[model samples]
Target: MTTVATSSPVSGARRQAAEGTLGGAPLGPAERAARGKAARARAPRRTHAEYEPAPNRADPIDVIDRQSRSRLPELVPLRYQRMTESPFRFYRGAAAIMAADLAGTPTSGIDVQLCGDAHLLNFRLLGSPERRLVFDINDFDETLPGPWEWDVKRFATSLAIAARANGFGPSQRREIVATAVSAYRTWMHRFATMTNLDVWYAHVDVDEVASRLADVLGGRGSRRLSRATSRARSRDRLRAFTKLTEVVGGERRFASDPPLLIPIDELHTGRERELLMGWLGSIVGRYSDTLSTDRRWLLAQYRLVDFARKVVGVGSVGTRCWVALLLGRDDGDPLLLQIKEAGTSVLADHLPGSEYGNQGERVVAGQRLIQASSDIFLGWQRVEGLDGQRRDFYVRQLQDWKGIADTERMNADDLTLFGRLCAATLARAHARSGDRIAIAAYLGASATFDQAVARFAEAYADQNEADHAALVEAVRTGRVSANEP
Candidate 1:
């Protein structure tokens, strides 16, 4: 583990902020950093390494079941089955379980709008509004203002688990985790010294990422970089349309894939179809209102052609996700938008409830706050489900140059570079909502916090495997249902 040097002189503005000389200030950067460091008096950094559940800790299965209660019953088994495949997969889908465990861990008492589920897989490449590809935290359904350490811990634990999955030994896993934390600390230091606009514009462009990887790992790095870039470039709207839609009877409609992508007409017919389409039309109307005037006008040019119930993601399989296809000018001109269900964030249990009553709005707000650039069409709406329950949904373009990291195919060196990239991105996200100066100061010139978090990652990875085994046992004993892919 390496310590970040923060020996540079504090700026005059930071000095004023720290000394309470700044108008209407709660505290200065120095004061806050001092307070943050003093937090170790009550909660020693080493204490975070402990992951033993309290005697009365809720059963992981029961917590999962509670989350599934509001989900589509038939699709719930798929979530379980996906999670049951491996400890890494289980970790991805077990945000609720980790939330419980994180609640019992020590904290730095610093809060930030977190990705809440900042696992390694959640960080990916996407197109910015400028159509420039950038790497960022791409998942925000579980985002909320909560303990900053919680997100860091989740990210670190993910690296440990993923390293194990990639056949890296314990020493390599620990080093990878430490490197991630070190990168985060170093970036936070840089951000703390930057102007607000600079921090806002700060992002890891995909080209820069490719160059950095090539510099580090030579030929293997170049190959991975090329693969990711090519994949993202190939996933534009035109390609998605060609792959996910078909022309039938002179009309373009979503292709059917039972239990995953069922077209609206396939699911309803006659009077029911009429009512459903009418309801969907209203949903689109409401969603359009949430967008900016220009975007709304841009969307109005397209006419809705079809929609489908699309199952997506490991943790979000049971959620009500839909893809709507729209045609612009002609059959060849098309647009696709995904309306994904957004429930209360998992962090809600650990922090004060959000001011936004609608979970969709919560997700949208948090995403705009953390992501360097968001989809132009991103919006939110509340809609009534088939079960007569009201649900919140955030809408955006389905796949705009999206490229996800293939962790399963990565070796130890590949995972290391990937971890570094994600850690830096996470630091940027936290800087948007948290006191970066204070955080950087508290982490000053020492590897104490980094090593402690790495230890926690190792312990939590062990706990994750144990919980995964328990789920396996539950499936074996018929205590839970799981459907194999």
Candidate 2:
């Protein structure tokens, strides 16, 4: 995380008007990156409609085996080797693999674009210098449109995974899953009353979120809530950036490092930088409206201050990611953008629909449609590899005051409240896409799905444990490698 400029109370009126109402701007490479401070995005985006599917083996699992074998992407086999360690551990990862598998699964008649990995751990609070704590879904690499059930099932399964990771027993996990399902059901019932603007305006702040969690979990769970929130606040972008990087001369920049945030000076010496820059520029034009209108304004306003290739998330471990530091207005006015490679969605293999112009754009669009409110600058792009390979991407601020209370750290009471809030929030998201009246009808009066999900969760926990053991074995045999960074 790097320091971000604190926003003044710029009218929500103007910001809202700027969305949809404002025309997009195109920016040339020289103008946008005079100092190269923003997230680099010079790649061509291939919407699903344009995608030429790579050949896969007769069996889909073979796809992972074949792809992982090539080591074309960062450490895929190693990631699975790590996932094999525990279903609970692996459950945190069900997003990617499940998405891969889901893309290949038989589907229901009903579908809406989805956040393929809508798990419990994905929600968090991002803070500003003004100390405003806003909670929202933080990851979109696996975003896609698919069966609505996929999102709900994924969210349900995540509750099970988090409970197991928290060291809760079978009975405990079941109860938590039920809590989540029921909360979702109840919340959707109320969403019908929310005005369009209200839905867009709805967001949870840290203090308010914590108090709600405290009411539900109580005792041990409540205590855990406090701990998780404290840890989250400490994860400030500037603070994390300082710990991970070093200052060279007068610049607040990163030290020379391998596979982490690397300095441009070190990169320009190698041909990869030029290739990357070209692709980044293309991605910008395809994904960002700024390329058309604000490119010159942005170019004159900011310079690239720093960048790095970062590894993030349990599932996103091996993917390519870069974080750019921008100095705007002056050195103190800063913004951090994370430019990550958006591979095909996990759900693409299962319930594929819509030939999107760009998968990354699909993600950005789905997120905005589903979320009550989205990052002001959220956008996507296509990046072309020198090898004629290309990947799509959606970009945004890395973390303003983002925080999540991990399930493992919660007390029972906090867990209950956390469960409710997450459940309700998820329902709100779903309502944004599909008809709530129908979904509410489908969930009418009974806790059957809640109960069914709980049962499925207990069974899945057993599977997770077995898988975790397999990963541990792989690590011992040198079949895969794992590292913190």
Candidate 3:
């Protein structure tokens, strides 16, 4: 086995090339492949299988606690409670922990706009701007420019953990992880041969994918896919408006559900309420400036009616998330937009800081670069809080054909198929922002990289189990408080 280098001259050049500022004319495919072969020699593919924790590795619980300091105090425990539900749930909330660990791992030094938190659950069916159902990555909270392998490792490990939750044996688990890695390798190779425009336009249409897999999915998996696609198509703005609002007296208002959803009026009163409403209303106008001309014109038609502080997702429970209800023309025409707080990515400390000053812009820029299609209303802004602190936020439709896969219901075959879909989607995303030819060259036409990543996934899954156990112990001994919401 080749020993990994702490820093290499080749790695530095690769990073510069990945950033598209390598101080030279564009390299042809042959030169690019040479650079990739050099990277492979410097960091052998087999070296990726290693996963021994450093003696001075940070405590996972401490990392969780540090992240909580910036979050709502009351809701931090709920984040912990949600994570403690299972090892898979724990993995979902533990991206920071994994990011810290991945810093010590070997990489090809290839950088891309990473999803940061690329767990399998984050890949799902979403509505494209054209209203077609597409399978793509939906989360960008932790997105940043970093090693492509970090996203791949995070995704593969999530598969291993989820397999364990479903009672899969070690062999079956390895197969599942390898299946995804192989798909990534295969897709990257395919992308290497495509034109830049083609690569940029490549996307997975859920309907097309369903048609392709109809034979292999069998009746059960086929039905599940149909239901998922149906649910996604039904989750448009109208559906969100109907489910989340009610007629209060004479006007539509956000329904109040404590802990999960609290109306703005319920949280503030008197002069404070008046000030908050004004600030939130101003945010709509300010955020609209970030959108394109057509989108801005469209947004100008909607009046901000109501907003609420809502608890959302496992890791994001404590972070400030607001759902705004907007109405156009009359009471019946509505748009639901979510304004979520954006913080520094979990990978920030491990890699270089983001070039965008506002974290919200960082997220928006990343999403636009990586996703083939994005929400029409996606935009960002900075707002001053009642406490006089300023925070960055990104706004988008609250539920635009969003559908998450139910992992618990998936059998081994179902998961393997889902893994393949996620892997291909991830490859397409990476290819858009990184050198596809070089990455494909490093992966080669071999099973070595795939097998090594599968091994690493299983090993890291074991480490994740230990970390989850530590959190559970902390809660049991009252070192950390965990309250179910």
Candidate 4:
């Protein structure tokens, strides 16, 4: 309901403060940052070292159960299975669990468009519009405006958990956490000095990342990065077309793979498929309106040929996700769009409701606001389910040169570099949505905040391991059934 004049430095800084507070209303970015820096005396940076869970903390399994009630029942076991893969994997799927815990952590009251699930694996390589490979936050499923430290803490904890799973020594894991926090803090400071446009335009190019790593790691790391970058470049629409579809009766259709990838025609009876296709067709029309005029025109060229259900991600396995296969010009020219169900973000329970009534619109809007370059075809619509209940869904290119880090294969040096890269990328994302000057000043030039967060990360990783163990125990005792595959 409140709006700030972004054009004026002093008014913008004043507006950055919480509503009903006139504390430093006449200041500029620098002064606001200085005020935030002075705030350390009251909410000391060292306070982040504490990581005790609340005495009344909700049971992790109970929280998981609550979320499961909204997802597809049949695919629930798959979500459990992926989560049971390792402590790191469980940590990846436990954002809701972390959200519950984070509600009780020390917060600076500075809000930002948080990645909400800012784990290390979430930061990866993707192709920018110029076809240049860049590294940025690749998932915004749980994005919302919330305290900045929550994102930082979640990221740091993930680094710690991942390092432990990778068999790193205690000191090595601590170093990774330290490196990550230092990178986030240092980058925020850099962003604080930059003009608005400069911050907006900044991105972490993978080639530059590789070059920087090359100086520190010599040929091996650089070669590994080069391979990853090359692999990402190759995973465009053509690659998806070749791998996910096949010609059937003179028409290209999605190949069926049971329990993971199922063509809609195969999953439902003929009459049911007919009814579903009609709804899907109408949904596409609605979703198209969410795009820009040029993009909608570009999408209008592609004729929908077929669609299939898809199981994706450890945390997202139980959600309704479908891939629509479209033919643009001919059999060789194709575009695959993923229509994924969107629900309330984990942060929504703690923060204000989204301005958009549709959850799909929330995801689409948050992605556009935070991502450096979003999918051109990204859009959303509301569709009625088989049960006759309407659900929100967002659509985007299924695989537009997206790549994820193989955290399982990373060594200590590789992991630390990864931590720094992810941390820096997160800082850039926060700078885009929050008061970077204040965040930077709160972080300060010294290593106090970094050190405190490193300690917190180490402690929270222990809690995550224990929570993961509880899930494993539930599976073992037949309290929760799961498939290992």
Candidate 5:
């Protein structure tokens, strides 16, 4: 790979071009934005629907590690933190697959959330402001654009991991994989033939979805399971949001948590809260542009209600995370947006792509490009933190009722239904960005991709085990620090 000196303005401009930023004369912000957007409208559009394998590429693992070395050191600690959550260090150590799959896949161009870590556990129903059950990918940390196949392979591999973790036999895992592959193939076919507007309007309401699944399953146990999952999801959101902000006559403030929520006593210097508020402004201006024409205006109307550094996600634990509560005409009329640091994409080190100036912005733009629909609040910016490094951040809503499957307790039948949904979601993402017709033709109405992934999963499983062992050694040798809570 060619290294460009980041210090030079010309090289920096070129680097920013890859990031979808344009430069021009010192025009007013409004004029510059209008001109840049018009240029984008007239720009040549190329879709990755037709893809072929690259020739004589370097080994993918080497490429991934090289890119990874340049990433923020905080990312390694974060990855380790999430991995330690389940003693399943293998799963934690091996986000490595995302790189390999991106490097290996045949092409189609897709633009969407990319899920960053697409797996069975990642997708769940989240409540919209209208209390409508809207389904969307809930994670954005590693979110970025690339070969959509990377998400698919990661999702499929995750299913395999969850199935094994849940104690399903290999045959059951294979059957689940087949179901998932089928769903993906079917969904891609459905999505490819869809009109752009139809694709944009797509969202699954959990109630209807549960009812539909109930119709298919048509049994007491299935009904009970569906109900239970729905309740868990709904309750999870409630648990996180109820204490989110205490709304007085018209102002919102977080309900108290002694140390967790940053006590009043902790504000002796008041610098932390000031830095947080500064970051919130960037979230609206930089992150929410991909929102629809109307929604962007509506978002701009809301005033900042409250913000605090809050802990979130397994992998994102301890990373600087903050939630900004936005109140509209009334205090009860609210919007909650989350601004969190964006780490390197799981595929970054592995895929053949230009280096990123800020991997977080890449994550933001990629998600907007690939997801059929995206959060109205999605945007990215860089902010200086106490550590002095300019942290790259992508911001979105917090506790939007986003839930994941209970992988720990799922049975074979549960895996079958859930894995298929995960697979179908992945394919929808890929179909949007990749040449679906060609991929469909390539998949050639067979389970070849499925088989290839399974073999890859098993092989990578060993690698994960080795990586996990290495992580264990790192902890023992004081290469990284942690405290068990």
Candidate 6:
């Protein structure tokens, strides 16, 4: 595998600021606030409530089919099947569809390192490098610089859809959605008043958050939170090692699981397998070069034992994903790493392309920029696949102390509180990369923007349902194929 060149799209002035060498004096708080106020005049906050589909809107199925063309043919059916499970499921996999819709929405001309697919599920519990559990945005697949409103709108819409799935009434759904937007608005304003270093250091500690919410959660919610945290802590590297690997002929290797976890040895034979393993080994070596000096030394201690092409997530099912098993010292010491394919950002069509030439680099850059903490092994590399095509891929631990919300079991009260937490986390992420003061200024002290976004969330949830029905009809009429597991 050959190495790919890296480059950024940021201009000299912006790059200087990013590198801690401001080209000139930065804008004062008052000037930044004025700029935000001017943007409000250009795109009134009330206008954000509107969400009528364009007369010339493209067919949603066509959009799905277009994305499928670049994915593995056999697994495309599986992706459709997952999406067909429910409207919320469809929304999870329809980032590209939403990116197009968000392009026509109102914005405050504010750009940030967006968590392109900032749905409610994407905000979750993660283990920081310091071994502390923190609530933060986890997915960076569709990340790019774009309007801040796009992320807010996608997140709010997800709450609306999820609330609907939980059998919430219209008033309940409205309150849930509004809670999230209000949290984002209020937190952004709070960040605006702090020093840049203080804002940068801000993060929500899971333990502290749970303790504070004890009274609000009462009996059932508190128990649920306790269970989730316990489950997350148990999902360490050793746990994944035991679950995914087994000894065969006195050798540790990945177990055979068709279409999901097919071992590399199973896919090729004899000399071909030898060559494939050597190629993958080289790719791993190249990826290590992207890490810092100390991390590179740490990674060098582990020897690659085996690898498998594994399927993962809703939209990522058809993309090439591999789970590499490495042994550090003995059979008990293992490190599981997931190497996932990175494609063009969904927002690329509607906004400026990333500065980074390699898509994998783009993902890594965005993650490092916004996440309060990141995986030590995180890195990216470009590799030539067996198909003779080069693809970009990012690597990270397969499982850390990761926990996702159980939205299915949540009540209206649970959802409202959970949505607020997600919104606050998202705001912290945005403040790390965007103009917090300007954004807070545009939102103002009123609930106008919050109420407007809640309205948009409901309307867009309606649009999402229609789009989901279109996909279901397509599958029924043989326009699309769906494979049930």
Q: Candidate 4: which pairs clash? A: none
RMSD of each: 6.6, 12.2, 6.0, 3.8, 10.4, 2.4
Worst lDDT window (10 residues) for model 2?
40-49
Better of 2 and 5 by TM-score: 2
**Per-residue lDDT for 26 in model 6?**
68
TM-score of each: 0.93, 0.76, 0.96, 0.94, 0.72, 0.96
> Which of the two candidates, 1 or 4, achieves a greater TM-score against the reference?
4
Full-model lDDT, candidate 2: 0.59
Clashes of each: 2, 57, 0, 0, 19, 1
Query: lDDT per prediction?
Result: 0.85, 0.59, 0.89, 0.84, 0.56, 0.88
lDDT accuracy of residue 44 in candidate 1: 72
Q: Distance (Å) between predicted and true CA of 46, model 4?
A: 0.7
Q: What root-mean-square deviation over C-alphas does model 2 reach?
A: 12.2
Q: CA lDDT of 322 in candidate 5?
A: 69
Off by over 4 Å in 5: 1-81, 87-115, 128-131, 193-203, 221-241, 246-252, 255-293, 329-331, 352-361, 384-388
Find the candidate with the highest lDDT and give its number. 3
Specify the poorest-scoring 10-residue window by lDDT in model 1: 1-10
Better of 1 and 6 by lDDT: 6
Q: In model 1, which runs have C-alpha deviations exceeding 4 angstroms?
A: 1-23, 26-28
Candidate 6, lDDT over the whole model: 0.88
Alpha-carbon runs more than 4 Å astray in model 3: 1-21
lDDT of 2 by residue, 172-288 (tens): 877888888888878866764565466556666667866765655557656665666777777765665656566678777756665545665566756777666656555543445
lDDT of 4 by residue, 351-402 (tens): 7766667888778777876788888888888888878899999998899888
